[model samples]
Target: LDRLFARHEALRSVFVAPQAKPRVEILPPDAGLPVSEHDLRQRADTEAALSDLCHEEERTPFDLARGPLIRGRLVRMSDEEHVFLLTQHHIISDGWSMGVLVRELGSLYRAFVAGQDDPLPPLAVQYPDYAAWQRQWLSGERLQKQAQYWREALSGVPSMLALPTDRARPAQQSFAGASVPVVIDVDLTRDLKRRSRQHGTTLFMTVLAAWAAVLSRLSGQNDLVIGVPSANRGRREIEELIGFFVNTLALRVDLSGEPSVSELLERTRRTTLAAQEHQDLPFEQVVEIVRPPRALDHTPLFQVMLAWENHAGPSFDLPGLSVEAADGLDQVK
Candidate 1:
């Protein structure tokens, strides 16, 4: 963990004056880890206790300006069994960072166990460098070029979708929400993949079009905007870095005239490719350029978010320790 902190500057960084003249402060390498240990071997209801711990860790908010935005907890359930919980603020990390974190952590653990020197190569670029590059490269004419596309694409877009709900929307929007898992069985999963290939689209594009169709039918609206996350790591150098590089893309799902499935997929393919081409411009900037009506009740451009995480799940194989992802504990959520 200490090695990870040293390797990645983001782990040691904190935001200052986030609302005004925002900047990051990287702490010293000597700063200690925030990991805590809890012994629950004497407890009878270990599973229940573990679940509560997970929820508590997740719900505890981070102090962005004060310092460390990441946390760790080690729970000793029995003589050999243990659970490791890690939490971090979204400002510092994203979905792709998890795979990098786990893989590097495993490599470090293995090398330490064998009494070998650090085997991982030095990072060519840090997260701060990437941020600097974005500021430098994505500006002036480049920014305007992409900004024009967003303005034209999102011209006169509806402020919000007429999504049906059992209860009325609150006066103000809140982050409080719960997720229910939707299972896609093997045959259906295979068929979806097959259909994606048949339509010359990726699985994400296919599922996205289908989700837009469902939302259109449910809301009784043909025009819809759905928010999707784009892993904004186009450069290979940034691929192994740990940072918040994910960008949101508001896709205009035009479900007019009851188009056939194939036609919809084709349309989706074109929209997705175009969005990808213009994805370098951050979502915040896109929102600013689009200039949708603002309200306290909902987000500006889109309400529905579809995150199709296609990254491979991380696997941990520490020396003489069994690690498996706990049910109901999602890192993404």
Candidate 2:
């Protein structure tokens, strides 16, 4: 825990706001992380007790300003069984960072258990340094060029998607949402990948093409815009650092002229390529440039979002510790 905290500056960062401009304040590393231990072996229903405990932990929100911003817990279910829970604020970490955290933790824990020196090399740069570089880099003609491209590309787009819903649209939008798991069998998954390759595009672009098609058919709107998150870690310097480097891109897909699947794929490919080129222009800046009409009920550019998570859970090969995914609310958390 000490090694991980010492290495990544973001782990000790807190956001300070209400100023002229908000900024992140990176604090010095603490002696150790805030961790709690619980033993539920004496309980009659250990599984249920553990589930409740995890749910409670997740619901407890973090204070961004006065924060370690991360917490950990160890639960003992039996003499041989245990579960380690680690939680962090979304501001401090992302999918890439999580992978780094787990991998580093495993490496550090292994060396500690064996009573050896830390094997990992020091980080080249921290998150704050990257932030400084970003502010300096994205300015002047470079920022304006990207901003102009987005304004022209998104001109005259429909204010909102006319998605048909079972219930009438509420005056004030509530973000109460639910997830329905759809199983795509292996054969279908394989075919999708194969088709993506044939189209000279990625799996994400292909899936995005399908989504745009579905939304167009349902909403009866030929022109559609959907938001997709990009890791924004193209630069080699910040790729390994833990920070909020993820950015959203408003992808506009035109389904006019009743194009076939192949034609749609081509359109999607082009749109993705263009977005990738101009992705450095932050989403907030893009909104300012486009000046899309805003409403209290909804967002300006895109309502629905698609996040392509190409990362899987980290592997923990520690002795006597079995790590597996939990079910239901635990999985959601």
Residues 1-333, model 2: lDDT tens digits? 767887889998988887667778877876467879999989999988997988889889998877889888888888988777888888888878877877787788788889999989888999989888888998999888888889988998888988888888677789877999888899998999999999898999999999999899899999999999999999888877877888899999999999999999999999999999999988998888888888877888988888888777666666556666555533311
Worst 10-residue lDDT window, candidate 2: 324-333
lDDT of 1 at 99: 91
Quality of model 2 by C-alpha lDDT: 0.85
TM-score, every prediction: 0.93, 0.93
Q: Model 1's lDDT to the true fold?
A: 0.89
lDDT of each: 0.89, 0.85
Residue 230 in model 2: lDDT: 91
Residue 22 deviation, candidate 1, in Å?
Answer: 2.0
Model 1, residue 107: displacement in angstroms?
Answer: 0.5
Model 1: per-residue lDDT, tens digit, 1-333?
888988899888898885588889997887865889989999999988988888789779988888688889999999988888888888888889999999999999999999999989999999999999899999999988899988988898888899889999999988889878789999999999999989899999999999999999998998889999989889999999999999999899888999999999998898889998999998888888888899999998999999877767888878977778876677521
